[model samples]
Target: MSILREARLSDLPAIETLVKAAYGHYVDRIGTIPGPMRDIDDHRYARHIEAGHVSLLFDNADGEESVDAGNGDKPVGLLVLIPQTDTLLLDNVAVAPSAQGRGFGKALMQAAEARARQLEFDSITLYTQELMHENLAIYRRYGYVETHRAEEFGLKRVYLRKSLA
Candidate 1:
């Protein structure tokens, strides 16, 4: 089974590590550091965790788990949520490279949706780099519709939204 929980202070380092490993591959593909890669760090994660904005995904399936046991439930995936007036912004969803293709990503996305509902949000919003076609497709498969496109921080982004109600 897999578990999703809000991050604690001790999980910041692992979160940062997982995020870097998850997003590092896109650096060369995008020809520049992805905004998430450049923006995420231990301090920021610490703040987010403290503010109740970060959640982590842990895979606990015996014999199928990939995380190290010594780390004490080290997270394989992460979700960063920012609550807005009427929506929950999924700022980031990342799965460690080693944990990709194991349904962890999809589970994390589902957890995000459940969280939005729990928080009384009517919708969820997110944006991905325009160059990351795979991510855009995955979000669409999750029922997120393209809301618009814009350039920010020198990168083209495709914004998407999904309604829960």
Candidate 2:
């Protein structure tokens, strides 16, 4: 089972670590990290959490039907879903390095889609750096169609959206 919940102030530290770990390598490859990663002074994560825009998802280890032993309520992944004026934006999704190969990202995205549907959102959108081919492919596989392209924060990026209605 998986548990998805709104983020709390206490969750910021862990969330920051998760985000940095997930994107650090990509930053090195891009030659310049985006502001979210670069200018995040201590005040930022807490501010975002307070704004209620971020969310955390945990895998219920005890609920997994595996032969191996199970754990409980351990934070395995996270994502920030931002509600724009007209569209739902998937800001960021990061699975712990140890949890990368699992389907956590897909599960998180599915949850995001379900949320959009419940809110009557017409579309869901996101932006990914052009060099992040792996993420671009993942979004493409899940029906996100590219609508625009640009260079932002010194990295080429593609904007994608999925029409929900």
Best by lDDT: 1
Name every residue pair that clashes in candidate 1: none
The parts of candidate 2 lying over 4 Å away from their true place are: 34-36, 63-74
* lDDT tens readout by residue for model 2, 41-140: 6466677678887778777766853321122244677767778889888877778888888899899889888877877799999988888899899999
The whole-model lDDT of each prediction reads 0.87, 0.77
* Per-residue lDDT of model 1, residues 59-110, tens digit only: 8777454444246767889999999998999999999999999999999898
Report how far off residue 100 is in candidate 1 (Å).
1.0
- Report the error of model 2 at residue 86, Å: 1.5
Candidate 2 clashing pairs, residues 3+ apart or interchain: none
Score residue 89 of candidate 1 by CA lDDT: 96
Error of 1 at 47 (Å): 1.4
Off by over 4 Å in 1: 62-72
Looking at model 1, report the run of 10 residues with the lowest lDDT sum: 63-72
Residue 47 lDDT in model 1? 78
The best candidate by TM-score is: 1
